[model samples]
Target: MSRITFEDLEALDDDDFTEDNSEPMDEEEQDRLFSHWQSVASTHQVSIPAEMAGPIQQMTRQSNAREPVPFATLSRHEKLDEVVYEERMYPAGKWACVTKGEELYEQSISMAFMKLMRYICKENSAGRYLGMTVPVLNEIQISKDGKSFVRDILTAYYLPAEFQQDPPEPLDPDIVIVQREPVRVVTRVFFGTTTEETISRQISSLWELLESTEDFLRDTYIVAVYENPGIPCRRNEIWFIRRDQ
Candidate 1:
């Protein structure tokens, strides 16, 4: 029989000691922790301070319909075709809670959901908001007028979700601080006007604007809020971020 040397024994000891013993997170554990919080939020019914409710509702109404016409959008679709468009930036950071939409089918659904989250955060409160972190590219659908915007508001727009075999995008949850502000959008398609040409043009323009403005990214997108789609108007937001870097 071969005798093990001190070094060999030490190596064995180290291997035994270093094995990662961290338990995998099971669904039960996740639910146990999360359910408690759910109960809390549900019980507390954290109402937006009365002062902030009107703006939130108005902003929601606006997101559902009415954004300034983006003359610059016409020039966008004329540019890039299939790529994930461009990364856009806003002036300020906002806080958000990511929520999902009904009958979600793709990761884009979740992305749009988080995007809405950011918008909702801004609209809900009058004061600045510093919110969550963002991860990946979700889906996007273009719109032109109020009726379509309202449709998106009702339908919850494009769903932001992950694809099968795809990893969940990383987000900072409640880490980086941000200052919340309004957001805007512009599109060419409207409710009952889902023309390929119009949707294509408006979608192209929005991507272009995002590409142009990415330098101002506060950090990462907090979340995509779902707005029932079908309201209209070219949208854009005057925004700002107020977190100490």
Candidate 2:
């Protein structure tokens, strides 16, 4: 297997991964894109909820005006093989989101991710085309099966800096753009192809690394994946949110 350097992963952030944002996709093109995305999902064994199979509602319009939101980094511990621990701060901003299984607490994170992708791909009400950003964030939970698995996930996409003030609304009733408060986080960078086994290992290592820290209050963590499926090298991060003392 080819090795993916951390530097390469960092470079991916600067790469353009979306269509022209100056003009949103028209209704017909939006439907085509959604249909293509659905076909891709089926090929991967992922299912799109029925409500998401059509054009999404747009509660607001995109004037195409944009202001860059500041994106920053953090401090890290020495690299321990594939895992590197880091402490960082994040300024909260607007996020395009889809959350399910909150009441039942049994929702699949994959579904939320699919729905959010739909919003970014111009399926939402305003037919906006938002560029893809790094670190697709997932609020993770250990499955009912325990530490051996991860489930009950909430997935989100960071709205591009331009829409930080008032993001275009999601057409899917279950999807919305909400502002998240600023937070301090500890993260472990996991480099490699992501699979359930490797992710579980990284999650365990994250807990162990956290346990060794002093004076840091932590209650939960999330996984931030930084690669597309076809990418040869990938960078996946497990983020532990620090609590207020």
Candidate 3:
């Protein structure tokens, strides 16, 4: 009887939608990621400086190929409408993560990626080298510009929440069997979005937009971000992988 706007459709009364996951925050992505970072920290030497995070993320933000753009210059959706995106958050590490896992062929790499990710997310939510994942079907290759790469891996069956206690899914047999590539060597953050689609076409659109630009997209360090339930996080961040200078 009443006209429901897009925003209205996007929003429903709290009473209308009860929380799906039972133990929302208790055993989710945060624990999994932080745990991994914690384990890796003992092996590394240098500690991340406190103030460097802001600048590091700023450096990673995608800018215009021709000229510099201000953060204030664009609206929020304008920034996120992209299929593939780059983001810089705290902890200073950067990444080029995506949303989908089904696009790639060899799902094993995805498993390895997840294993490495859980190690980080469970160990250090606040450390260098955050974990993130994006969906791509093409071979993950480093670019001539030396800033981007395209690799594909199949990641069968992803858990929407609570990864800390969850076992690694998508065993070798479960995957579609496409192609696999080692993750680029970079320090990164894993930000993901539940509202987003991780399928190949969507990822391709994201990839194409970046590919057209003078800036390169190679050795794309893909990280997967699982949003916290309580936080207003539906979509996630996908920053480019950092290259060693």
Candidate 4:
């Protein structure tokens, strides 16, 4: 099936597409359309106003309403004598991941997220419905140009405890289940929708704040979003892996 571009979605008319006489699309069709849109949106980059970010937020909220993936707090500290970041340890766990080479961080996220969403929603070898998990984690590699561009993004969803022992295989070849080892990271919290500019600014701020005292991997970092995109005061975070870990 051909992919649906962002322009196509914008061109669609609700009245014409959802006419009273037309039959509703089947679950399979719906999933296919959603996945296609996500694939297309991942390549399309644009700024979204807070009001216009609702639909995307709603989609994320529905998927993340389930229990959050567990993690442990190893330590907390202030940067430059101010509360800036924290250190945390996440245990080894299983995750469904999709990697995309996209120019923009947000675009890669939108695309990868829908793909992973399909897997947990029953597009797997077991055909079992594995519900969603909170705080979609995105590992992003910054370009050598000094954070001016993004090379790629690895979007991951932690598998729920029920399926962690024997997670189903993904029907999509691009999606995979992998075992992650425990690791320690330094993280900073932010709010609202994440755009290329906003994310870059946050990374720079954190980098500068910790530059003098900590040793961290500068090439890549993790972007974690914990709340529904549509809600106000949403929680988002940027995590830097500690080099000593």
Say which candidate scores most in lDDT. 4
lDDT of 1 by residue, 1-245 (tens): 12323233323322222222334435664443333223222222221223433223333323323221111221223334543222233332222333333332222232344354454344322332222222211223323442221112111221122111222222434222223343332222222222223444444454454544543333221222222211111122212222322
Error of 4 at 228 (Å): 4.4
In model 3, the runs with Cα more than 4 Å from the true position are 1-106, 113-199, 207-212, 218-223, 227-245
lDDT of each: 0.29, 0.58, 0.30, 0.69
Worst-scoring 10-residue span by lDDT in model 1: 150-159
Summarize candidate 3's per-residue lDDT along 1-245 as a digit string, tens digits. Answer: 12323343345332222233333333344343333323222222222233333322221221111121111111112345542344332221122222224323223333333433333333233333322222221224444675333333322222222332333332222322222222332122233222223423334455554534423344442433332211222233343443432
Model 1: lDDT of residue 226: 23
| Ranked candidates (lDDT, high to low) | 4, 2, 3, 1
Error of 4 at 12 (Å): 22
Error of 2 at 79 (Å): 4.4
Better of 1 and 3 by lDDT: 3
lDDT of 4 by residue, 1-245 (tens): 34445455445443322222224456674554345344434334533323323233234324434768788887777756876888888889999999987666676776677677667766788886676677789887777877465657888999989889999999999998899988788889997657678888889888777755457887878889874332334479999988766
What clash count goes with each model?
Answer: 65, 5, 50, 0
Q: What is the lDDT of residue 8 in candidate 2?
A: 52
For model 2, the superposed segments whose C-alpha errors exceed 4 Å read 1-44, 47-71, 79-83, 101-107, 143-151, 192-196, 211-219, 230-233
Better of 2 and 4 by lDDT: 4
